[model samples]
Structure formats: structure tokens, C-alpha cells
Target: SNHQSWVDTSIVQYISRDRLPLTRFFTKFELIYIPIVGQTFYFLDFPMMRRHSKQAVTKNPALAGKDIIEAKRACALLKDKPFTLLNYLEGTRFTPKKRNTQQSPYTHLLKPRAGGLALAINALGDEIDGILDMTIVYPDGVPTYGELWQGKIKRLGVDVRHIEIPDELFASLQDGGYENDSATKEQMFAWVEHLWRQKDERITSMLAEFEE
Candidate 1:
């Protein structure tokens, strides 16, 4: 599965080779809801990822404004450090059937949950200037984490594209209050949607190339 492939890949291998200074600001449940070994993760000093539930946040006036503030604090903790923050925008993996059922805006990816990324960017500010957009391709089929651990699945490919955020988006954030400002939030959301659209196009072209 992709887990083993991830271990074998250049990106993961390179990161593992060095004792990198990094903190992961990931989704909360991955750390909290695990069965027996969840508590052990806290020993590593990885911050407990927390995100407000969509419904709860929307309903509560106090919580509605907390996302950006919390994200800023998280980003502040990681500033000037060579750390990797893995945020899964889709919030879950994709299967072909799910893709069909969801009719996602992006052909290659599940629907992106934009709120987390928006907060991260607002928090990180100029600290994060580039993004390495990674595409994991499983020509045979998508594999589960268990399959990957057992060494049952193999033959995977990865493509990395380093994308620069357009200056306008950065400038908008720099103006301050991106989260609370309705106009700025809309602009950022539109920009991200455009990026996802392009990603869809790129993935389609790449898959066609592989087929040929």
C-alpha cells in the first residue's frame, strides 16, 4: 500500500535520513481516536491536533472566530524550524467509488476542506513560501495501511510539483484579518479552488501519459 511506498519514496526517505527539526500540525482524530496506542504518541511531543466541528463552530459565536487564532498559535510554535506539517485537505482518502459518488470538484482528489489550510497560511505568514504538491499514483490499485505494512502491495509512483502561492493571496493575508474579513476569505477560497482545478487537470494529463 501507499504506506510502504511512502517509506520507500525519495521524499520520505530523505526526511527520515536526518534528524529534522519539525512539528506536525495535523488533523486531531488521527492522534486522539486510535485504539490502544494513542496515548503513546504524546510522548513524542507532537501537539494534539484539534479542529472545531463544522456544525458546532457555525453555531457558536465564540468558536466561530477561533480557527485562525489557534492556527496562528500552532504556526508560531513551529516558526524558523525545518518542520513538515502534513494537512490532508481532503480530510480522507479517495476511492474510485467514492469519487463517483461524490462527484468531487477535483477529478484527481476528494473535495478539499479549505478551512484548515486557510488557517495554516494565515498563521505561517511569510514563513511558508512554497508548497510541494505531491501526487501519489497507484496504477494497480489503492492499498490500505495494513496491506502496506504487510508488504503485500508494491509498484507505486509519486510526482512532486513545487508550487508558488500567488503574491495576491499572500498580500491579502498580510493585510491582516484574513479570517474574519469576508472579502479576503472569499478571495482566498476562490484562489484555492482554482489551484485544485489546475491540479485536477494536471492529474488527468499525467494519468493519460501513463496509459499511453
Candidate 2:
């Protein structure tokens, strides 16, 4: 999904809770140490990833590929359970400042991150029913987490539909080629970028409907 704010979590649950299985998402490893909320997420089986910087991996070559291994391990844990795994492909909430900093080509989105989605597919592709593209729009302005709880947000739009993964690309991702092969990685990026462009246009259209 194209993330907008913290409120997106509740929105996703609101929209999917009944229709799907248990929902899980990836979280930063450090979150587990924060407080009650963090501990709760850990117990709920959220995948906690410790991402290493390129410089850190350069310093210790052994650190290379560890995150991918960890991600696959985390995903495999959910293989037997019926679950809806949500990856915010943009990797973070959208902000004007972030958009400019990223020099994003999309009018309403950041570039999609391919690795996380690839890892999920590699581990859980067969267990899941289908891939879904979810586009969320807050027709009122983007609200702060507190604003959402306070009932300040008046309008929202959410679209969720099945997306078919091309067979060749699906096979490549399922085989873990996305991590090891440059061509496969590029193919994944191109596919995700195409989706993001469509999502960006849909966001524009969703917002327009609010105006009318």
C-alpha cells in the first residue's frame, strides 16, 4: 500500500479485519525494546528486521545478506497460519518533504522498495491466496495519529483488489533470485514501479471524486 500516516494501520484493519486472516507487517528490530506497544507487536509475531547500512556491511563483510536471511526466516514462521501480510512498498509514510528528498517520479508516492515484497513472496507465495494491491486515500488532509483517534478525519478512500503476478516473475521471486540475481532485481523494481504509477493516478482520481 502507499502509506499516508500512522492512521493507515487502523484503516487497514477496519477494511480487512473481517475479510482476511490475521494481519501482520514488518517492523524495525529496535521497536521491540520500546515499551508496551513494542512488546505487544513482538508477541503478535510481527517480523522485526534489523537493517544494516551499506557502510556497516562494507565494514563487516559477514554482515552481508543477513537481513534477507532474517526476513525469509520471519516469513517462513507464518507459513502454516492463515495471514494477510502487508508491506508498505514505499517503506514509510508519504510526506511532501520526503517526496522532494527522494526526488520521486510519482506525484503522490515514494519509490517502492522491492526487497521486502520479494522476500515475502519467496517465503509465503504458495501459502497466500492472492496478491492484493491496496490504494488508500485520505480525502480530507492526512491526519496525525491523534487526530484520527479524535475523530477529526472526515473522509477516506480505500481500494483493494487481486493482482496477478506474472508467472515468470513469480517463479523468479519464489526461487529467491530477487536477492542473488541483478536482472531479477531489476525486473522486480520495474514491475513495482509500474504499479506505483497506477496507484499515483488512482490517488489523483480518488481525491477528485471527493471534490465532486
Candidate 3:
């Protein structure tokens, strides 16, 4: 669904983030934070969360067993159509201070939090064929949103790799009920871990190429 307007306004270059298009539809969970801004999103029918602790759910008498329920609700919202769900697994933009503090395993990636992705796979089950693992490299250096707007940033490299879901894992999802089946959940988790490992390797290879 490429919008011709995006290309017509000399926005193609500005819109490309590491060569990836700026606007795209997303499925799965999107965590939106902003007071007034979030309200507009809600008006448009976007899912909003108050941000609760996973531990609190276990300790509180009234809050037990809500994770599955929430995940299920999200699944219902995104069950159809091809959409891109934007998730920052690093949970935020990359910065030298944060990156060093986190000691990220991937050279250019933030450590992936697999829980959300796990829930998405469990909820969607076979509905999603696989994931498009994306890598955004800023040749000139990562730019803040403001910098990009000010026309201060230039040059970027983008790569998109489609990671195929292995048959075993797909079968596991098909046979095992997303929430109730333990085996399928474990398999999906393992698959996500494998993808993260490959991503780390790819980042290293890409950096080497950039240097050369």
C-alpha cells in the first residue's frame, strides 16, 4: 500500500529511515505514550494500556491471570490484514549512554524483549506466517526525530530480511492452543531466541562491511 503522495512531495528521501519507508500499517501491540496525542490515537480506535507490572499481577489477589486475557484482546484487534506493528524492543531510541549501560548483545541492536512477540505469536497462531526482521543503519549516525525534521541528518542504510517460520514451530502453533498449550509456547519462544541470535550476527557482518 504505497501512497503515491508520499513519493510526490520530495518526501521519499526524508521518509526513508535507513531506506525503510516512513509510513506503514502495523499489527500486533503498539505502546503509545503521550497525554493529548494518545487520546487522538484512542479516538481512532488504537489500543491503549496504563502500563502495569507483571509482578503486581501475581501478587495482587484481584489481578491474577490477566496477561493472557490482555494478549487475547490484542489478538482479536489484529487478527486480519497485513499490518506492520512498530515495537522498539530496545524500548527506546539508541543512544551511546543507554547502549553502554545496557551492554546490548547485538552490536547495533538493543536487547530484544521477547515477551510481547511471544504473546503476539501465541494469540495470532498460524495467522501470521513469519516475521520481517528489519535492520536500520544510519551511515551518518542515528538521528533524533527533531534532527531529521531540521534537515540535519542525511544518508542511511536499510535492510529488511524476512525470517521464515520453521515447520516444526508452525505445526506447534497450529496444534497447540495459543494460551493453553505449553509445548507450543516453548517452541515459539525458542524460535524468537534463534532470530535474535541471527540478528546479532547480521549486525556484526553489516558493520564489518560498512567499515570496509
Candidate 4:
């Protein structure tokens, strides 16, 4: 998803029903200390990373690489079951102002943060079956999360493509793994970029239909 709104999750979940299991999302470790909801996510076993601010990491260099360890440990729980993991690769909700400032190549997306996904895949590549690449769109315009619950949202769209894991991707987790290996990481990023390009076109094509 380009992440225009929080409503995307429920919309996608409705459309994808039965095609996948209930999804567990990755959360920031800080959220785990929040009131009820955060604890619920912890109980539900959502992977949580204690993300470091750049300034914080700069102040304490040892904090680097800690997220990788947490993600790896969390993924261990998924090894014995068929689980759906949801990641918002865009990392944040999109706004035209933000997109322009970023000078993103795709017309409708933020540049994906590849590291979180890469680390998860590398750590649990063996336990995973395949990846589902899904694109979510709102034709009229982005809606606020409130608009969704109020039944004010109009047309919504979803497209899905599945990708199989290549054996070589996780061939050696012991030797620094996917995150540490420059070549493999780049390969994954190339794949993500290719998908984003297609998603840009797909949204364009879809919107054109509404225009017609």
C-alpha cells in the first residue's frame, strides 16, 4: 500500500479473507509498554523492535544491529505455523507534500524501507513459504480512518501478486545473513522497486477506468 490511510488494513483484510490467515504486524518495542492494546499485541506475539532514533544511536553506537536480533528472535515463533505477517513497507502514511519533498520516483508511493522486511525474510526464510505482494488503492482520493468507519468511503481496490522465495536468498544465515550480505540485500531492493513501479502503473491504469 502507498499508505494514504489507516483504513487500508480493514479493506485489504476483507478482500483477502480466506486467502490468508489472520495477520500479525511488526510493532515498535516502545508500543509494547502502552496500555491495554500494546500488551494485547505483545500477547498476540507481534514482533517488536526497539527502534533507535538516529541521534540516540549516534549517542550509543552499540544500539546498532539490535533490531535485527529482536526481529530474528520474534520470527522464531512463526517457524512452527503458517502465519500471515503484515508490513507497511511505506513505513508511514503518504501525503503529497511529503512525497514531493522526498522526490520519490513512484507517483503514489513513499520509498519503502527495505531493511525490516529484509531482516525478517533472512531470519525466517526457511520457515516462510512465499511472499504476497499486495497493492491497495482508493480511486476518489485518500480517506481518513474515520471516514472508513462512518461508511463515507467510496470505491476501494486491491491487487495481489505472489512471489516465491529463492533458495539462495537464505543460503547462509550463519554467515552474516541477508541483511549483512550486500548483494542479496540489493537483489531484494531491486525486486521491491520493480513491484512499486508496477504498482504505480497499475494504479494509473485503474484510475483511468474510473475516468472512462
Candidate 5:
């Protein structure tokens, strides 16, 4: 999904409450140190991932690829369970400043990351039901977490639908080619980029409806 703000987690939960299984999302490791909310996440058993900055990885070279190992371990733990694994492909919230910095091809998004999705597919291929694409738009404007609690965000748009995985790609991912084969990784990246492009257009159309 296109992440906008901290409120996205609640919105996701609200939408999937009755339809999906228990929701478990990948969270930043540092978040576990936060107050009550962090404790709640810990108690709920959400996966905590440490994302090393580029500079940090460069300095300690050994830190490279650690997140993947951690992510795989997390996915293994969830393989036998029924749960909605929510991954924010953008990796962070969207801001005009960030868009400019990234020089992203999509007008309304950052480049989508495929690593997490591939890992999930590789780990839980047989157990999964389907992959869903979720698009969220703040038609009025992106709201802060406080604004959400204050009932200040009046207009919003959310779309959720199943995403069909290409047969060849699906087979490759299920076989664990994503990590072992460079071509499979590139294919996964391309597939997700296509999804992000559609999402970018959808966001534009969704916001246009609010104007009318």
C-alpha cells in the first residue's frame, strides 16, 4: 500500500477486521522501545525489523543482508498461522520532499520495494490464499495521527482488491528463486513496479472524485 501517515495501521485494521484473519505487520525495531503503543505491539507479537541506514551498513559491512535473515525468521514463525501480513511497500510515508529527493517515476508514490513481498511469497507460498492490493488516499489532505483521533479527517478513499500473480513469477517465487536467482528478483521488482504505477493512477482518480 501507499503509506501516508501513522493512522494507516488503524485504517487497515478497520477495513480488514471482519474479512481477514489476525493482522500482523512488519514494524521498525526501534518502535518496540516506544511507550504504551510499542508495548501493545510487542504483546501482539508483531515482527520488529531493524533497518540499517546505508551509512551504517557501509561502515560495518557485516550489517548487510541481516534484515533479510531477520525477515525470513519472522515469516517462518507465521507460516503455520492464519494472518493478514501487511507490508507497506513504500517503506515510509509519502511527502513531497521525499518524492523530490527520490525523483520517483510515479507522480504520487515512491518506488515500490519488492524484497519483503518476495520473501513472504517464498516462505508462505502454499499456505496463502491470495495477494491483495490496497490503495489508500487522503482526498482532503494527508492527516496527522492526532488529526485522525480528533475526527478532523473527513474525506478519504480506500480500495482493496486481489492481485493476480503471473504464473511464471509465482512458480519462481515459490521455488525460492527470488533469493538465489537474479532474474527472478528482477522479475519480482518489475511486477511490483507495474502495480505501483496502477496505484499511482488510481490515487489521482480517487482524489478527483472528491473534487466533484
Candidate 6:
């Protein structure tokens, strides 16, 4: 789901606890070097990724692609099991400032980052049963974590979209379909744009009800 506020996790987990399996989130590798929190995630088997800088990769070619490889290996352990692996295609929480900075086409979202999503698809495409695209909205106005914790949250708007993986998209992932392939990458961008358009419209409709 596209992140809107800090309380989004609590909302999502609270609402979806029974509906979906417990999830494994993709986290920054540097977190592992932190104290107990990092170790907790590491022990929970979350995918820890080192987002290498271009300069860093240029300096050490061996570091190239290492994070994705490790993430995939961790995903492999979930094979034949029921688990939720989540990727936030937008990479970061959405704010009006970021939206304007990016000149994002969608009114309520940041531009989707393709590479990390592609890596996830490449790793878990075959095993994942369906693609679940969720858009979370707080029509009462987004609340801070403190407000939510203080019981200030009232209504929430959540749209859960489930779609079968398209054959062409799946094929591309199976056969090197990420940044390296122009056609496949273009197709992915188009699909993501389509999804975002629908999601934006849904948010519009959801907000309309708030006024009514």
C-alpha cells in the first residue's frame, strides 16, 4: 500500500490481521547494524537490502546486485509457505511537498519506483498467489502517530485490489525483465500508471462520501 501517515501500519495490521498472513517487510540493511530493533527484524526474517550508491557500486563491482540476491535467497525460504511479502513501490511516505517535488501525475501518490518492485517481482513472482494493490486514505485528514495512539482516529478508507499476474509481466520477470530490458520496463511503467490512476479515482470517490 502507498504510505500516507505513520499510523498507516497500525491501521493496516489491525484491519487485516485476520485476512492476511503475517508479513515480512523489505527493510534497509543499515537497520541491522542498529540495536535491538534491527536484530528483531533480522530475527523475524525480514528482507534487509543495502541500497548501494552508484558511486559505491562503481568503486566495488562485487557489491552490485548483492542485496537483491540476498533478498531473493531469504524469499526462497518462504517457498511453499503462506506468507505476505510487502513492497512499497513509492519507496517513501507521501507528502504534498514530495508530490510537488516529483511533479507526480497522481494527486495522492508519489511516483512508483520501478527497480525495487521489479526485484520483488523477480524474486517472488512465481510463488505469490496474487498481486494485492492497496490504497489507504484517511478522509478525516491524516493523523499523526500520536493522534492515532491517543484514540483520535475516527474513519479510514481502504481499497484493496486483487489481480492475477499478467502472463506477459510474469514472463518478463522469469526472463530478466527489470531495468535491463526496455520493452518490459516500459510495460511495467504503463501497468503501474494504470493502477495508480484507478487508485487515485478511488480516493476521489472515497473523499466525496466524506462530504456527503
TM-score of every candidate: 0.75, 0.94, 0.67, 0.88, 0.88, 0.92
Model 2 per-residue lDDT tens digits across residues 1-212: 88989888888888997799877898888988898989998888887888888999999999988877788788777776787888899888999899999999989998889988898888776776798999999887898999987889888999998888788998988888997899999999989988889899999999999999
Q: Candidate 4: what lDDT?
A: 0.76
How does candidate 6 fare on TM-score?
Answer: 0.92
| Candidate 3 local lDDT, 60-157, one digit each (tens) | 84665466566557546655544444444454555656658988655555566655655556556767655666655555555566666687756554
Query: Please, what are the lDDT tens digits per residue for candidate 6 over residues 67-172?
Result: 5677688687677568777777788899999999999998888988767777888877667677788778888888999998788888888878786656988779
RMSD of each: 4.1, 1.4, 6.6, 2.3, 2.3, 1.7
| lDDT (10s digit) by residue, model 5, range 1-212 | 78989898889998898899878988887898899979987887777777777799999999976766787776677776678989899888989889989999988998888877887777677777899999999977888999989999887889999999998999898887887899999999989988999999999999899888
Candidate 2 error regions (>4 Å)? none
Stretches off by above 4 angstroms in model 1 are 1-23, 29-40, 174-178, 209-212
Model 1 compared with the native: what TM-score?
0.75
After TM-score superposition, the amount by which residue 207's alpha carbon in candidate 2 deviates from its true location, in angstroms, is 0.7
Which ranges in model 6 have alpha carbons more than 4 Å from their true place?
none
Per-residue C-alpha lDDT of model 4 across residues 1-212, encoded as one tens digit per residue: 55778787787678668988767777887897799979998887777766677798899999877767777888786666667888788889888888898998878888887766776675676576777877787788888888888998778777788866555654643234554677877776876787789888988887777777
Score residue 158 of candidate 1 by CA lDDT: 60
The candidate that wins on TM-score is: 2
The Cα local distance difference test for each model comes to 0.61, 0.87, 0.54, 0.76, 0.86, 0.80
lDDT at position 158, candidate 2: 93
Model 4 is weakest, by summed lDDT over 10 consecutive residues, at 170-179
* TM-score of predicted structure 3: 0.67
Tens-digit lDDT track of model 1 for 79-191? 65577665556656666666688887656677766666666676777787566665666666666656777886666556666777668767677555466578877877777
The whole-model C-alpha lDDT of candidate 6 against the native structure comes to: 0.80
What's the residue-level lDDT of 133 in candidate 6? Answer: 84
